[model samples]
Target: MSEVALLLQKQVSKGSWVNDKKVALIVSGVVLAMMVAFLIVPILSILSRSFAVSDGFGLENYINTLGTSRIWELGLNSVVMASLAASIAVSLAYAYAYALQRTDLPFKGILRIVIMVPLFAPSLVQAQGLIFLLGRNGVFNRFLGFDIDIYGFWGVTLANSLYTFPYAFLILSAALAVSDARLYESAVVMGAKPFRIFRTVTLPSTRYGIFAAIFVAFSLSITDFGNAVVIGGNFNVLATEIYNKVIGQGQFGLGAVVGVMLLMPAVISKLLEKQISKRQHAQVTDQSTPLQIRPNRLRNLVFGSYAWTIAAIFLSVPLIVFVASIVKLWPYNMAFSLKHYAFDVQNGTAPLWNSVGVAFATAFLGVVVVASAAIVSAKFKTVLSGPISFLSILPASIPGMVLGLGYVLAFNNPSNPFNMLYGTFPLIVLLYIYYNHAQGFLISSTSLKQISSTFDEASTMLGGSTLRTLFKVTLPLIWPTLLGVGVFFFMRAMVSLSAVIFLITPQTQVAAVSVLQLSDRGAANQAAAFSVCIMLIVIAMLLVVRLVLWLAGAKNVTLIR
Candidate 1:
C-alpha cells in the first residue's frame, strides 16, 4: 500500500472503533431526553411560573408572595422544624447505627430490621399512630389520666424525625461498616481514652457520613408534606403551604414562588450530600479491616439498651397501625373487627388494587429505565452521561409535592404536549419512578462501578455486541441490585403520597392517598387498615422476590440486609 493510503486506512480504522460505541451514545441521549421531558422541564416550568405576571415574566409574583408576613413565618417554621427534626433523627440514627455496626449488641439483626419499619410505612401512618397513642382521647393519654396534644410543631417534628430516621441510619451504618479497624487498634496501643479515641478517630472518620445524614434528613423533613398535613394543624410549614396555595386555592403563581424558595435550600443540601458521598467512598481501602468490638459489660449494656429503645420506637408506628386496622373503633368500641379492611366506604378496595397496579408498573418501568441509564452513565461516560446521571439523582433533592405541582402545571396545560397524561395512569407511574429514581440509580451504579472494566473490554474483543454483553454478562452480575431496585420502587410507590397526591383522580385513587382522605374525614381506623394493607402488600412482594431469587439459585440476594 502507498504511505498515504496506509495512513488513511489507519485513521479509518480508528474512526470505526469510535463509531462502534454509538449504541451507548444513543442510549445515553434517549435517557437524558426522557429525563429532561419528565424531570427537568417540569421543574424549569414551575420556576419560570414563579416570575410570571399579568403582562410577562417579572418579579411581581415573587414580590406579592414574599412580601406577605405569612410567607416569612412559614419559611422560618420550616427551617426551625426541619433543623430540630434532623438533629434528633441524626442523633438517634448515629447511636443506633453505632450499636449495630461497632458494638456486639444483642439482637443486632432484629434491631436492624425493626429500624427499617418506618421506611416502609407512610409518614401519615406514623402521624396517625402518634395521634392514636398521644392525641386527645388517645389510649395512653386517657389510660394515664393525662391530656397530651399531638399537634402543631412537636407533632410534626416527631413524625418527621421518625419518617427520616432510617435514611440517616442507612448512611451512618454504611459509613461505620467500612471503617479501618487499625485506627482503633493503634489508639488502644497508644492508650488513648475511649472518649478521646471516639472523638478524634471515629468522629473524624465518619464526619462526611454525619454531614450527609444531616443534610439528607433535613431535606427530607422540610420537603415532606404528608406528616405536616396530618399533624401540623395551624402550624404551617413551607411544604403544606405550597400544597394549600397550589391545590387548595389554585394559586399556582404563589405556590411556585414558595416552591422556588424551597428549591434553594434543597439544592444546596443535595450538593453538600453529593460532595460528602464522594468523600465517604475514600474512608475504606483494600487495607481496611472490619472493626470487631470486644464487649465491655457496662458499655454493651448501655448500647444494647439504646438499640432496643430505638427499635421499639421505630416499630411502634406500624404495630399501632396494625392494631388499629383490626379494631372496630378507637377509644369507644375497642373491639377487634375486620370491617375496616372491607373498605366499604370509599369504592370498596378498588383503591388498593389501583395502588398495586401503579406500584407494579413503577417497579418494572423503574428498574428498566434506571438500570439502563445507570449502566450507560457508569460504563460509557459519554458526552451526555454527566447530565443524565445528575437527572437520575435530582429527585432526591426535589420534594415530591413540588414535583407533583410541577407536573400539574407542566402537563395540565392545554398547550403542552403531555396534556394527555394529566389525569392518566401512566403519568402517575412516571412520577413514581422519577421521584424514587435516585435510590435505584445509586444502587445500580454502585454495583456497576464495582465490576471491573476489563469484562467489557473482553466482551467487545470477543465480538459480543454491547447489548448482548449487557444482557448476558452485566445484567446477570448486577441482577441482585436490579431486584433491590424493583423492590425499592414498589415499596415507595405503594407508600408514596406527595408526588402522586395531586395527580390521582377519583377514578384512579391509590391506597396511600385514600388513607390520607380517610384520616382527614376522621375515619382513623379505616386509614390504619389501608396502611396495614399497603404494608402487607410490600411484605408479600418482598417475600415473592426473595423466593424467586432463591428458586433461580440466586440465594444471596437480599432486598435490604
Candidate 2:
C-alpha cells in the first residue's frame, strides 16, 4: 500500500481517506440541500407568486401595491415603529451591557438573568400585558381613573421595544464583555477621565456589536406582525399589509410585493451589518484571554440599578399578563374567571393541533440542523466551514417577514415543478427551521468551539471514525450545549410569528398567529389565555432542559444572567 493510503486506511481501522472524505462530503451536501430546500423553496414560492403576471412578467402588483393608500400608510407605520422600538430597545441594551461590563455591582449574575427574561419569554406576554394595563378599561386605566388605549402605533411600539431588549442586550453585552483591559489601564495611567476612556476605548471597541444590535433590533421590530396584529389596531405596516393582502384580500401578488418591500430594508441593513462586522473581525487579535473590567462602587451601584430596573420591568410585565388572563373583564367587574381557557376555536379557524405539531416539528428539526452544522462547521473549520458558518448566520440578518413573503412567492407557484409543499404543514415546518437556525447555531457553535480539536484528532488516530469521534468524544463534552440549543429551538418555534402569519392556511394554523388573529377580532381574553399558555410551555421546556443538564453533570447552566 502507498504510505498515504496505508496511513489513511490504518485509521487504525477499516477506512480509506477517499471513503471517509466521500462519506462526509455526501452527508454534508445532503444536509445543506435539505436545509436550503426547507428555507429557500418556500421563500421562492412567495416571490414567484408575487412576480407572476397576466401577460407573463410585469410589475402590475408592485405598481398597484405602491399606489395603494393602505399599503403606503402601513409601510410608513412599519418604518416608524421599527425605528422607534429599535432605538428604545437598543438604548436599554446598551445601558445593561455597560453596567455589566464596566460596573462592579452586587449580584451581577442575578441582574443579568433578570434582563434575560424577555429572551426566554415570548413577546406575546408583553403584548397581552400592554392590553391588560391600557386596553380600554384595563386595570391601570380604571385603577388610575383614566381610559387608556393600547392600540395603533404607540401600543405596538411599546410592546415591541420592551420585548426585544434581551436580544439587544445579549448582542451588545457580548460585544462589550471582553476587551483589552490594558487599554483602560493605559488610559487611566495617562490621566484620562472615565467618560473619555469610555468614549475612546469602550464605545469604539464594541461599535460593531452596537451597530449589529441596532440593525437586528430594527429588523425584528419592523418585521414583527404579532405585536402589530395584536396591538396595531388597523395600523398599516408592511408586515400587516402583507397580512391584509394575503388573508384579507386573498391576493398573493400584492402580498408578494409587500414581501419584496419588506425584503429591501432587511437586505440593506444586512449588507451594512456584514461590512461593519467584517471590519470588526479584522480588528480582533488571536488572544485567548479577554480582559474583564473591574467595577468601582458608585459605578457598580448605578449600573446594577439600571439593569435590575429593566429586568424587573420585564419580569413584572409577564406576571401582569398572566394575572390579566384570569380576570373576567379587568376593572369592569373586579372578578376572575377560568372560562378563557375554554378554547373558543374562533371562526372554526383556530387549528391549535396543527400549530402545536408544526412548532414541535420545527423545534425538533432545528435541533438536528444546529447539532449537525455546529459539529461539522465548528469541529472541522476547513475551507468549506466558513461558508457553512456564513450560511447558518446569513438567515440571522433576514427578517422573518421577508422569509415568509419569500415563501409565498416561491412555494405557492403552480408553474414551479417542485411546488408540492404549498399550503401544507411542511411549509410551516420549513419556515420555522429557517428563521430559527441562526439562534440554535449560535448556541451550539459557541459550545462546540469551546472544545479543542485535539480530542477528535486523537480519537481518529486511535481508529475512531469522524462520526464515531463526534458521538463518543465530542458530544459527551458538549452535551450541555446541545441541550441548550434544543430547548431554545422548541421555545422559539413555538413562539414564532413572522413566517406563520404568511404560511398559515386553514389546515395549517399556529398558536402564535392564532393569538394575533384572536386579538385582531377583539378576543383579548382568549388571546391573553393562549399567549400565556405558550409562555408556560416555553418556561416548562427550559426547566426540563436545565434538569436534564443537571442530571448529565452539566454545571452552572443558568441562562438568567
Candidate 3:
C-alpha cells in the first residue's frame, strides 16, 4: 500500500489534493463498462438467441439462417453491390479529387459545392430523386424518349455511387493534397514522363487513401438502407433484408440475425477509417505541398470536363426528382403545380417534430457527454487512459444497428433496472452518442493537441485550480471545436437512422425513417417534399451555424475535417 501510494504520488504530484488522474481512471472504467455494455449486450443476445433451442445453446439459429435462401441472397447481393458501388465511387472520386487538386479548373468552389449537394439530401429523398429520373415512367424516360428501367442492380450501383462519392472525394483529396512536392520535383528533374511521374509519385502517394476510400465507400453502401430500399428492386442487400425482416414482418429474431450480419462490413470499415484518421492527423508542412500541376490547355480541359460531367449527372438526378414532385402526373403533366408540396402534417408532422425534438435533445446531451468524456481522457492522465481511448473508438467500429440492438436487448428486458429508458426519446439521444462519440472525441483531441501544455503549467504556478484553468483557458481555446462538435453531432442525429430505427418507437418516428417509409410506400411526391424539407433544414442550420460563428467573431466554422 505504501509503495502503491508512492507510485501514484510520483505519477501525478504531491501538492495536488484531488487525484484528477485517479478520478479519471475510475470514471474511465465506468465509461468503458458502459461502452462494452453498449457494444456486447445486444450482439451477445442475438448470438445466444440463435443458439438457444428447446435443448440448449445449439446450432439452431445457424440452421434457421441457412434455411433462408433469401437471406443468403441478400448477403450475396450486398457484397456484389458494395463491390461495384465502391469501385465506381473510388474511380469517380479519384478523378474528381484529381481534377480538384491537379488541374487549374475554373469555378472550383462552385464545382466542389455542387458535388457535395448529395450530403444535404436525406437518404429517402435521394432515392426519391433516383426514382423520378429512372423509374419506368421517370422524367428521364419521357425527356429522353426512352423507357429507363433504373430500379435494379444498375440503379443501385449508380445511386450508391452518387451517395458515397463525397466521402471518397473528401478523404482522397486530403490524402493527395498532403503529399510532398519535392518527390514530384525530383521525378520531373530526372526527366520522367508525365504519366510515369504520376505513376511513381502521385499514385503511389495516394495508394493508401485509394484503398481506404474503397473499403469505406463499400461498407457504407452495404449498410445503407436508403438507396437499397429505393432503387434496389429485389436487389435485397443485407440492409434492406434487415428492414424487411424487422419492420415489414416484425420478425425480431430474424431481424436481429440479419442486423448482426449487416454489422460486419460496417465494423471493418470503421476500424480501417479510424486507423487512417489516426495517421492522417499528422501535420503536413509547407514543404509537403504537392507540386501543382500546370496542366496544358488540352489536358486541363479534359480532366475538368470529366469532373463537370460526372458532377452534373449525379446532381441532376436529384434535381429532376425535385422538378417532378410538382408535376401533377409526371411525364403526362407538362405544366408544374404546387400540389406535391401540400404537406399532410396531420398524418405525421407531429412525428417529424418528435424526431426534431429528439435531434435537438441529442445535440444538447451529446455535447455534454462528449465534452465530459473528452476532458476526462484528454486533460487527466490515468491507468485507464489507454482503455478509455480504446473504448472511445469502439463506437466508430460498431455499426448503428449493432449498437442499437445492444441497447434493445440490454434495456428492453423487463427485469433490467434501466428498461425505463427503452423506447423513450432519451433512447434516441443516447443512440446519437453511441454513433457520434468518436467524432466528438476526435474534434476535441485535435483541438487539445493544438494548445500548449505550458499554459497549464503557468496557470498552476499562478495558484489557479485545475477546474479554474479549464474554465478560463482550456474551454475558451477549444470553444471552436466544441461548437463544431455541436453542429456535427446535430447533423448526424438529424440524418441518422440505422441505429435510431431500432430505438425510435411509433410515437417517436423520425424524419429519416419516415422518408424511408414514404419512399417504400411509393409516395414519391411526398418523399420528395420531405427530402426538400430535410435539405432546406440542413441548409438553414449550416447558415445559422455560420452566422453564429460570424457573430462571435470566429473565423473557423467547418464541422468536420
lDDT string, candidate 3, 312-402, tens digits: 8877866876776677766677587777677664355665677568767877777777777677677766676677677676676666666
- lDDT string for model 2 (97-139, tens) is 7887767676877777666666655566667777777877666
Predicted model with the maximum TM-score: 1
Runs with alpha carbons beyond 4 Å of true place in candidate 2: 1-15, 68-73, 146-150, 281-297, 344-356, 375-390, 408-424, 556-561
Provide TM-scores for the models: 0.94, 0.88, 0.91
lDDT of 1 at 381: 65
Please provide, for model 1 over 1-561, each residue's C-alpha lDDT reduced to its tens digit, 9 standing for 90 to 100.
244443543454655435547978888888988898899988988988898888999999888988899999999999999999999999999998998888887777788888888767777887988888888867679778887888999999999999999989998998888778889999999999999999999999989889989999999989888898888888989988888887799899989999888888888988877876775557678888877678788888898888888888778778878888887888788898999888888688999999999999999999999998898888766888888887888888888888888888899889888889888899999999998888889888888988876777666555555577688899989987798889989999999898888788899899989999998889898999999988889889888998888888888765863
Give candidates' CA RMSD values in order. Answer: 3.5, 3.5, 3.8
For all candidates in order, the CA lDDT equals: 0.86, 0.74, 0.74
* Residue-level error in angstroms, candidate 1, position 362: 0.5
Candidate 2 local lDDT, residue 145: 80
What is the TM-score of candidate 2? 0.88
**Per-candidate clash tally:** 0, 22, 0
